[model samples]
Target: MLKVQEIRELIKLIDQSTIDEFTYEHEGEKIKMKKQILTAQAQTTLVQAPVETSPPALQKNTAQVEIQPGAQQHTEVAAPQVEEQRGENLAEVKSPMVGTFYHASSPDAEPFVKVGSKISADSTVCIVEAMKLFNEIEAEVSGEIMEILVKDGQLVEYGQPLFLVKE
Candidate 1:
């Protein structure tokens, strides 16, 4: 559990720190956090694991996003590999709620997609976990993965860009 001040401080750190993962605990509560950077977008995730009965963040499938401080900032990113996709920017796929984003269905598994991977409109691009429920994230448009906006296991905000795909 986190106090209001602690949450505020965490937000400040989130904004300033380039590191993607953060964790803190007190008393009987334990928290695990992770962040990642692909393109310019960011993603984050927070998990509470107690000493007993470690909650399965996702038992079926797990997406891991690691946000590190040294990761490149999206806004400051350069378009080095997107020469073919020039003149048109990648489409942004953002989160609809606050939760964890997973690239794979489970831990020790391959991600759903990789950079330059072609995705279709009905593709199951990723997963977002909220309140113990895992939600499937689909690509609304078809394109090539230009940039991964967020990291795996990242905690994402509502309407935050998750991936940038070039059409």
Candidate 2:
């Protein structure tokens, strides 16, 4: 376990650094933290509620999504098991492989996507550099990007949620 002061200092360091997210594993405790600016559009999604009246109504409403490259967005759908819970409609874009996630192709390149960016189905949203090779990731769903869960050049594990999109 980390002391409050230690956690505060870590957050301060992360705030001052150029990176957007930070993670460190010590002993059996794994801590992963991300710093997202929470753009205006993303803020709106938080307060919005899903229009869920029936089971079939939920799936029918989330049929179409559009994603674009360098500004890809993700959509949120209520989990099947959690349908009984009210007001949870968010989609997540997951990292396909295990490696370091890069927002851009290189250090000097612009980030592939950011909060409020639009993405399409074939758009290359980000890249995961592993074993000296860079693998481009695409947006499987199309929607307005609500949040960025990881920082550029951060080490991400497989199946991690990289972005959250509003559906």
Candidate 3:
């Protein structure tokens, strides 16, 4: 639980620092923040970006988008590696609502599951906190968790993939 002033202070500190990203944790709360230095070209050329899917912020997934002068702008994202790696058989566990993701009931508790952990359809995999409500998320598909997509205390969007399960 970070105070608003604390967060503002962090933003100021990070802005002044040379680092582009920073992560801090204290008393069961974890926060990861990043700042991007966009050129005028990049800013003016970005396609319609979803607030939930800030593709450019991923950096690794960024593609070189070139727009000819006076031409129309269009969306052209590189195929996500997750899609390529998950293949056709993987099932994604998606968030039911927009919220902050938590890996365990408590920060000190063991995470519900990890990569390679087997799960039943009803097994609790994580929790999503929305509007002060903590909702336990179940692994709807019985399988092994191949990947955990969201980080602890990270904001998640409705229908966003949280885990990849192999059934």
For TM-score, the strongest prediction is 3
Better of 1 and 3 by TM-score: 3
Model 3 poorest ten-residue lDDT run: 75-84
Q: For residue 160, what is the lDDT in candidate 1?
A: 64
lDDT tens per residue, model 3, 87-128: 777888887666799999998999999999999989999999
**Following a full C-alpha superposition, what root-mean-square deviation does model 2 have from the true structure?**
17.5
lDDT, residue 110, candidate 1: 88
Best by lDDT: 3
What local distance difference test score does each model get?
0.57, 0.57, 0.63
- Model 3: lDDT of residue 104: 94
Residue 95, model 1, lDDT: 66
lDDT of 2: 0.57
lDDT of 1 at 134: 93
